[model samples]
Every structure is written in structure tokens, then in C-alpha cells.
Target: MSEGPGATAHRAVTVRGPLSDARASEQARGDHHAAPLAAASWLLTTAMDLHRMAGALAEGLTAESGDDAEAVARLTSRWTSLHRDGGPPAEHTRLEALVEIRRPRTRRPALLWQWSGADPVAALAASSGRLARELVAVSQAAPLAEAFVGPVVLAPETAVHFVHETLGHSLEADNYRDYAAGCGLVVGSTVAGPQLTVVDGPLPGLETSRPRDDEGHTSRSTPLVEAGVVAGVLTDAREARRQRLPRTGNGRRAFGAAEALPRMSALHVARGTTPHAELVRPVRHGLYCRGAWGGGSVEEFFVVRPACAEWIEDGELTGRFVYGFDVKGRKISGLGALGSVGDDMGVFNPVTGCGKYGQELPVSMRSPSLAFDRLCAVPIAPASPSPPP
Candidate 1:
């Protein structure tokens, strides 16, 4: 038995006593326990098989490692709310549930594998104090500067931030079909370099990583672009068959509500020979885009609200870009201005989800702190969709 993110343990525990059917019923019926929100807690005690194996593997993998990390403390909780709408169909009340997991450490215990039936708070409380302390230590000591070194935790929001802004929604087949609104940087027609490529997959161990898609399709690695050449788009079952291209396991939806599209998972641009220092060394004055608050782009126009940024002087990063400059430019020019690429990749989490055509899907995108020769900084503004045909 094993526990945590990479754990592979299987076991079950049963509690025999007075069932709380009454409490659950009361909560559902708007009684004393029935409120806008409801919560439950429990103490999960394993027979110690999973945790023991996890400890052994951790020792083997981290032998002589200098970096400090937390033990795996995965807290997956869900929040539900009732919705009533008046529309074409009829007036109805619907329940929506949101599930999330927070595995702060490199190693998680067996609790990560156990599901408590839609209740996330109880799963978190099951962990001991030792795990909590480890998480705290990792948070306090681990600086974002070390992001260039190894695998870092990327929540869903951040993952979507990278994908939507960097890769996922940008390279859709439809987007490139007839020079659609924001799809000018064609795969084979774009830039040229050995370091430049685009890849998407449902690789195991990633939050967006899944063995099969919603259409019962098996996952496979598909090259969106190879060394600046057009490879293909992230196609779903329909698109794959329509275009006569193999499915890339991209068909997915937001909890089975909306239709699937050519979504992305584990999307990234591979690293080049440039060291982290050299990647920024050539820049005498430039910007570093860490994350995005909000922005939009068209094939002719792309704008981004920088989460954080700093200035470069003689290859050294000065203080944060206090002038508050942001990134704005055309897709072709933007991609053309790229001076260097990093070897970093961002993975999926629960926070960020891709939204398109009234649907949202899971995704992740990776890239180094790319350097650009000259990036136009424009002010943010209210979004106005392009004029309809």
C-alpha cells in the first residue's frame, strides 16, 4: 500500500454504527441542518500499509536532495449550490458541485487515494500535524526563483493561464482554417528554430492527464508543431475523423455539461541550450511575464495583463517594472519578437479551466521566461467581440 500523489495503494475501511440517514435527509429538506451550504468531517485511519511504502519510496527518490518539500497533504473538497433558472425549457432547481485537491508536498500519504464521497474538508482533516508542518515549511522556504530547476506545482487557474495565453486555444485547427479571428501564426508557417515546437498529451500523473477521453478514446501524444513546422491540431473524435487525422485524446468537457473541442493537456514548448541566465542576459531592457490577470487576443491583436514583471539592465533583472508596462502586440510580431525560450513546463491543477464557445476544459502549458526584442505595452479595456458577419 502507498499514499499521496504517486501512491498506488488499495484498501477499504468500514464503520458500523448508527447511520446518519436522518441528518442527511434533514439537510436536503431545508431543515435545521439544511442551509445554503453543508459540511461533514471524519477521521480516516489506515492500517499503515500505504504510508509505510510511501516513506520508503520518498527516501529512495530524494536521496541526497538539498531541496525541502512537504509530505503530500491532498485536500479535495467540493462546494455545492442550488440554482433556479427561468428559460426556454422551464423553471428548475439544479445542484452544482466543485471539486478540488491541494497536494502541497512532494510525497502524499494514503489518504490521497481514498475518496470520501464528495466531501473534501474531511479528507484534509484526516492528515496528521506532521504533514501540515511539512506543507508550511515548503511554502515559507521555497521561492519562485527556483522554478527554473525542477517540477513545480501549477494549479488549474495558472495552468489555464499558460495554456489559453500561450498554447491551448491558440492553435486550434478551426482557428487556422481560413485566417480566423486569432489564428494567424500557422504551425509550419510561423517561426523557425530547433528549440521551437508544440506538444500536447494526457501524460500520466498530470491533473489533466487521463488514460481515456470522454468519447472512450485512448490518449496519445500528438505534435501540434515540430521545430516550427505544422504537425497537427488537438483534435477530438469528430474532428479527428472529419479531418481523417488520428485522435489525440483532446475531446473533453466541463463535467459532462458542454460539448468537447480540441482541448490541450501537458502542452509545452521544449527547452533550448540557453541557460536560465543567458536566456535573460541578452536583454538590456525587457519584461518578464509571470502570469496573467486577464487579457484577450486576435490574430492581429494580442494583449496580456501581467501578473508580475521586472526590468532587465545589461542582462541583469532590475526592480519590478514599476512603470507598470504590459505586453501587447500582434500574434506574428509577438512570436517573431521571441529572443529566447526557457526549459520550464507548467502542469494542470484544479483552479484553471479553459473556456470557449460557452464551454470550459482542463489544460496546461509550459514555456521558459521568454525574452522579446520589443513588446508593445497597451492599456487594458472592456472586451467587445469583433463585428459579426
Candidate 2:
């Protein structure tokens, strides 16, 4: 919260594009109608002068706010424009048209589509159209399934989210101490197997992505997991110094928050050669989590609310749907139980925000489908809201 030379700020708002999503996501959340979304005031965060703090940074902050905030405010009429029934148009869905500033612009402009096969920018328009249709179709396809336990194939979107909630959050430098003390997450220890790797960095040309951290540290990729080992943890200037670790450019803050802390920007779980279609090949009886309600992790325990899932029998989808299922497991056990990783790394702009310590931030994840062996899922109440993570 220091108003120093390295200070940085972010402007944000939540919106859903196209009229259909505004209506559908309402139902997706078990609401009868799409309620209006309102954005809060801009957040300005200050921390140690990253240049002075970290000698070899890639860039520095400037006094002039010559970036997307101005344009975004103008378009939203300082947010009065957000009153419109529909949100940002389809052509502007990828968000490249509205703003080019990556370091400080974070907006949940829309949650139209989720795709896993190609470049995010090029596929945004088509992906949203396709996914919006899928959301409706999947939800209406069938009734909920009975409680079950076995192998499970988490869709690309849900899989990345599982990693984000479990492993990614544990990698935050400040959160590392808490987990290490109680959850057995040792830095140099091999927790997840060699088949997986996770990273958090300034992934340019993606929505809700950041180039430099809030503390003015340049966008640098920090390895959270590499070839199955807990390679490194994320850190802002304060935590890095406090913990005697290197800064990872992961500092972030939200409006109405006390200060910037280490957080993720573009979280990526490396892909594998397994085809998306063949992910369920080994599952004799299990669930295929097509979409997720939301998930959370505390210490080592975690729970994922899969909004829509299909039963898999004899290595194929049974075509019957299951609704409102919770997949619960321990972090280390789940990672070690990873059965397969798909090549189709999904890119998504979900409406559900990532919340930490009561602050919510718009973020995105690119991950592939993941299959796990011996995952136990129980049925939950049918109609409920996704709890904040």
C-alpha cells in the first residue's frame, strides 16, 4: 500500500457477452434469470520499488497511465455503459479490440465459450459461440447420476482448474509456508510425477493476463512444477525477501484489498500426447467432468464441484448425464493419481472469479484434459451456487 515509485494499479469490471450467456450462466448458477453485474472502483497497489528491490528486472513502471484503463473507462462511460442488457459484442469477445494493456487491465468481460484445441485469440469468436451452445445442451441432456467412485476424466477446463485450486495456490510463496508446515509440500520434494509441469507468468495476448506484476517486476515465467518436482514457488517482492527467495513477478491486488500479494496471472499446466477423444479409454467405470461449478483448497484438502458430468463405462461415455457432483481428495494423492494428460489444452474466460482472502480477481487458465484413477465422487444437492474460491 506504499505510494512509491514501483506502485501499480488495475481497473476491473464483470460482464457477460452476448445476450444468451447472460441468460444461460444464470441457469448454470441455478438462477432463474440473469441478474445485473456491477463493477467496483479501480484498485491502485504500491509495493517496494521493484527495480531497487530486484536489480535485474525486465521493465519499470511509469508515472503516466498511458494504457487501456483510459479506453476501458471511456467505453464503459466510467461504468454507466455496463447497464446495457448485453455485454461486449461478439467481435470484441477476445478483448484485443478494447485494450492492449496487459500489465494492469483485468476485466471479466464475458464467459461465452471455452475451447481447448487452438490459439486463444484466433479461436475466441468461434469458441464462445460453440461453447454457449454446449453449455445449454449438456445441462439439458440428462438427469443426475447415482453416487459413484472410479477412474475420472476431467475436461480441459475443469482439469486446469483442479490444478489451480490444489497445486497452483500452494505454489504462491506466501501460501507455501502454511502448506509446508501442515501439508507436507516441501520445495525440493517430488510430489507430482514427471508427466506434469505447472507455470505462472505474464502470458501476453491473453485476456486477464499480466505482463509485469503489480510491484513492477517484469513478466517472468516462474516454474511451479517441473518434470514432477516442486521446482519453485511464486513470490512478490515482499514475500521473496521475507522468505529469502527470488521474486517471481506474481504480485497482484484487487479492489477493496489491503495490499498486493503473490497471485497467479496466466496459469498453465503443460499438455501431453493423449488425444482428447481417447482420455476415457482406460476408465471402466467413472465420471467425465465436462464443466465445473467451482473448487477450493485448504492446506492439503480440496473439493471440486463438477456441475455437469457423464458416466463412463467400458472406456466410453454412457451418454447419461450426472448433475451436481463433488470430487474430494488430498492434493498430493490427486497429483500422484493422475492417469493421463490430454493434448488439447483448453483456454477459457470463465465468469466465476478466483477469490483469495476475500478479494476476487479476473484470471484465466490454459490446461489439458486430465484423467485420474480411483477418484471418488458423491452427489451433492441439485441446485446451489458456486462458492467463491
Candidate 3:
């Protein structure tokens, strides 16, 4: 609850490649009866591109390390692309890659990554290369002994995760009630800044887009937070009736056999007019956080670990910093601390799956870079140093 000495501020950043809505439509209109050989050719081309990109990235890292065998221990990937017609149409393609950078004497951690979009091969290459660089930096840096507790910026990619965990989850009718079953969230509570608006619905061509819920309910855009106020919460028919709230068409099931529950589709934070530089320029000392490996929550309290982060001095990135701290805080409090939002919005191809009960649902998030004024980051002990050879 109290800021400690050595406490520094932090922010988050994520870069996603471009996806063409037009191309998605074109694909939808193209002949559905293409030859099997043509489909096979496309898959082969994508596979080769991924293979080349991974090899090149590993080679670059190895060259920098001055060891031929230290660049990569193993590289494995899985690819899935399918097109289906019937019951409102369904089409999807995905590539998941794991890259392990070899180190002397110690077993290095593997980077588990994924991509889905119009050009997944290109996305995979770019993401993989960026991750390799981060791993190298992580290996050479010293862990922070003290935690940072203050203002921070959440990069577009990081903001997506932050919003999803803190805002989106908190706005779920069931989840919110589970945590506040007796008191419940106030409908008009001030949850964030005036510039922060959150929405959940279908954005066709994007990864989370769906024409209907698993129960065959037509999808519609629902505003969860409007201009900093709690406009609404995602709910299914049962929860809506139980709570006397309106159904927002968010009821969804993981599969045909699973029961329906309230779930988010393409949840995103509306962008603002502020230039990204404006968000960081005023902060004399803070962090530029990037990437979300994964995180967990209990009630309204949550902890998220960034994949990589850098020190920000005088509003500019200064040096790469060890990322072993948990950005921990209460959900509402975190959103309330929003300082500014940027115009650079990113809609990531859904990679991480959201799970509740015994089912996993595919979800996507979009957000601009966001800044928060007083948050907490608790230092986590770094992974033990590798044993000497």
C-alpha cells in the first residue's frame, strides 16, 4: 500500500503487423472450390517462410554470441489453417512456434509464441525476431532487487492484456458477481479516465469476430465502459435475469458440448487523439513495458508479468531492464489511475486463450498505448543463475 525506496514507474509496448480487412473479404468471396493442390501449395509456402525466418533469427543470435551451437537448441512449430462453410461461416489459420536459445551449461527457457491473421507467416517472422533479441537482452541483464511503484505506461500490446485482465474480466457479469456477489458493481461507477472507452463485439476479419454466439444469438457491439463510467457488463440470459440486467449478446460456449456463459469477443480500448510521445515525454523516470507472457487474478487483485521492459528517462527509452517484477494491483484502482491514452491502436491476432470453468475460449484484444499514474510493481526473485560448466 506504500511506495518504497527504489520504486520506479513503468509502461508497456506492443507492435503488430498490418492486417487487411479487404483481403479478408476477398478470401471470403473467392472460389470455395479451389483445388487441393492449391491449398497444399499455400501451406507449403507458409511453412517454408517460417522455417527460413526462424533459422535466420537463430543464426543472428548465434553470431552475436560467437558460438555456432549456442543460438538455438531446438525450434518446433505447429500450423493450422481451415475454412468452413455452414451455420454463419467459419474460417481460421494459426501458427505457433517455440524457440529455445541455447546457453552454456544451463537450460534456457523456450519462447512459446503464436499468430493468426491474413499474413501469419510474416507476423510469425517479425514476432520471432523481436523475441530473440529480447531473450538475449534478458540473459545479459541483472535482476532488480527492489520493486518499482509509481506511474507507468502500458504499451499497446501490454495494454491489451492489462485491459483484458483488469477491465474486461471485471466487467463480466458472472465474474464480477462472483467477486462481489453480495454488493455487486455500481452501474455508473467511475472506472477510468474520460478518454478510456472499452467495447466488446464483432469486428469482422479480426481474430475474435463471430457472427453469432454458440447458442445462435446474433452478436452486437456492447460498450462495457463509456467515457470512464461503467456503462455495462457482458452477460448471458441467465445472469441477466438473475441480476435484473439486460443481455448484451455475449453468451458463448467453448464448444458444442459446453454450457453457455458470458464471454468477450473482440474487446478493445478506444483510442485517443494524444500522440504516443506525449504520454512518455512528461514522465521523467518510468518504465516502457512490452509483451505479456501471462498473468493470474484472485478476486479484483491481479499480477501480470511483462515479457520485456526498458528504463525510461526524460521520456526516452534508456536501457533494457530485467523483467522479473509482477505488476500487481486491484483492477478498478489500476484503471482509475489512467493518465493518458495514445492514438496507436493494435488489434493482435488472438494468441493467448482465455479459460473459465473447464472450457477455453478464443478471444482478442485491441488497445492504444496507455499510461497510469500510481500503480504497484512487486519484485519477483529472478530465475536462479545457471550452474557453472
Candidate 4:
């Protein structure tokens, strides 16, 4: 292991076993006919003597986790991609495995679990065993209910995506300096409900938790949003110096890669007094997502695909599986839609990392189940639910 974040810990050792990069791309796709997450087109690579290297690079990966099953499931979707780019020693002995679990009635709503690591046996066993259980959860699901395109009740596992995308990305110094400001995300302003509070810092006992940033600054909590207001922005040493702002220890970068930039470490969304189940008790014509396959954002538009969901009507879940549903909308619009926050908080230390400027870095997030309104829910084909009541 590297001693310091800035130190280039290049391993030049020879491998005698099967080792693969488990950093997965576990994003769920909306298409039924499209290639599954397992269809990673990996090319063979060879690294023997000096100046010799070979690998199987995977593209179009969905990002998964560990109590943190939500993170594992998400990163493992596109799990079989092994990188042999002759850059890092770990890349030379990488492996990827994807497990597909179908509901028997239809293939449209299949459960995918992917794993990657140096050891193929361990990776496969982990991915397959976990996904098998989730498949059972949706086994008795009603015939792929028709899509519901309205408000949503997101569980803690799914709620992290909401804050990570619309709110988390918005607080990045670069984002705030560029696009977010134009979208009305000004600092020191109330952007969410009074109950909503978001903080970015290193968490103890969490995987990939950085005690210090890549640039050698002690990691400290940076409040991005407090009581629904934009309280702080993440900054690296460079940005802090340039903007005359506090360097919040968020500077990050990939090893042997480019320079570090301001980034998020462990994001903590404070829990509310409301119970988790209560959020769904009032939804009459919406879907309740229990977990997410994966999610991301592009400027103002954000999309989070629900891996497992239930139909809610008459103030209770129907216990029916809702598949292929997408929660998407303008980031700014979703800010004020905080209906409720749950007391159950989830910590996600996924195998997959966040990407920006072509650099991917490992990160973790924590949040409670959050309820929001006004965001559109778009269910894909073959699993459409009935119209709202």
C-alpha cells in the first residue's frame, strides 16, 4: 500500500494467482434487448518480460458493495471487466464476473450481480450469493406492474443517489464556479427543506474513508447544505488559494494520474425524525424504491434507476415488484421537494469510484431514506404500471 496519497505506489511484483480489479460499473440499463452488464467485451492482454503487458478492458460498466449490500449490487452490474493497460500492477491480474437472476415470468426485470477482483472464485461467489437473495425478495412480485410516472418515495439505499447527484455535485467548487450558479445554486442560500442537512467529510470505520486528501490536507467535514440551505462548497488547496475560500480537504485524484481536484469524501445526510415506512404510508400513486442499481448526473439533468421497487397505493406498499423505472428531473427543481427523511441511514462504500475529468476515485456516501415530490418517474417497456389513482 502507498504510504501517502501523493506517493506513487507502483507495484512491480509478479502474480501467481487470479486477481482482478473489482471496481465495477454497476449502472442498470432501461433496455430489455440491449446487452446485459455481463457482456463486457474484454480483450486479452499479455505482460511477461520487460515492456510487456496485456489486459481485458471493459467499457459501458454499471457501478456495486458490503450492511452495504446496496453499494455492492450497484458496482457489480458490469463486473467482469479486467484492465491490463500496463499502468498499475493491480491492472495486470484483474478479473470480472456478472450474475444474472431472472424472475422466471419475464426477462425484462432481471437482477444482475457482478463482481471483480484478483481472485475469480471469491468474486463470483460473492456476487452470485448476494444477488440470489435480492431475487428472492422480488420473487412474488406482481406481473411487472405498469409504470408510474409521478412522485416517488425513495429508501435510504436509493436516496444517496439523489443527494450525490443533484446536491453533492452542485457543491463541488468547480461546479459551483461554473454551471451550478447559473442554475440558481448560490452559496449561503436555502436550497432544500429545513430538515435536510448534508455534510462531506471522512467517516471513521468506513471503507475508503480518506483521513486526508491527496494533497496532504487533514480531512474535515464541509457542510454543503444545512437546513436546506447551501452552507459550504468543497475546495482543494489550489481552489482555496485561487478563490480565497477554506480548503475543506476534498482534493482528490487517481494514483499515478493527473493532479488532484476538489472532490467529496464521505457524504452524510442527517436523518429526520420520521420513520422509514411512514414515507410510503401516504403515497397514493407512486413507486417506493428500495435500492438503486446505479445513478449519475449531467449538468442539470439527473437519472437514478431503481433496482428494486414496490408499488404504493392507498398509503401502503403493494408488495409487488416494480421494474425498469427511472427517477429523473432537473436538479434545481428537486431541491425544494423534500417531503420527508427517514431515521435509517445507509453508508455506501462501493467498489466503484466516482469519475470526473477522466479520473476515477473511490468515495463513500451516507443518507437516510428520503421522500420527495415533483420528480418524474419513467418506467421502461415490458414493465409498465397502471396509471396513477
Best candidate per lDDT, number?
3
Put down candidate 1 lDDT per residue, 1-389, tens digits, no spaces.
12111111111222211122101111122221332222323212221222333333233333423322212222222222211111121111111212211233543221122223233333334432323323233222312231121112122222234335544556664455525323555545655455566677755434456565555567677786677655667777767777676677776644434355666756755655556677666766554444344455454555565444444567786544322224555666655555555555433233335566666544544454555565565443436999999
Cα lDDT tens digits, model 4, 203-312, are: 76344466666666778988888888888989987788887899898887675564678888778899898887788787877777765687887887788876767767
| Model 1, total clashes | 16
Ordered by lDDT, highest first, the candidates read 3, 4, 2, 1
Off by over 4 Å in 3: 1-41, 65-105, 125-140, 180-185, 382-389
TM-score of each: 0.56, 0.67, 0.77, 0.67
In candidate 3, where is summed lDDT lowest over 10 consecutive residues?
A: 17-26
What tens-digit string does per-residue lDDT give for candidate 3 at 97-207?
Answer: 233344444454424455555565666665775567665656555555688887788777778888888767777889867873333345687777799898898875467
TM-score of 3: 0.77
Flag regions of model 2 displaced more than 4 Å: 1-124, 128-133, 136-146, 382-389
Measured with C-alpha atoms, the lDDT of residue 145 in candidate 1 is 34
Q: lDDT by residue for model 2 over 2-24, one digit each (tens)? A: 22222222223222222222111
Residue 304, model 1: lDDT of 60
lDDT of residue 365 for candidate 1: 48
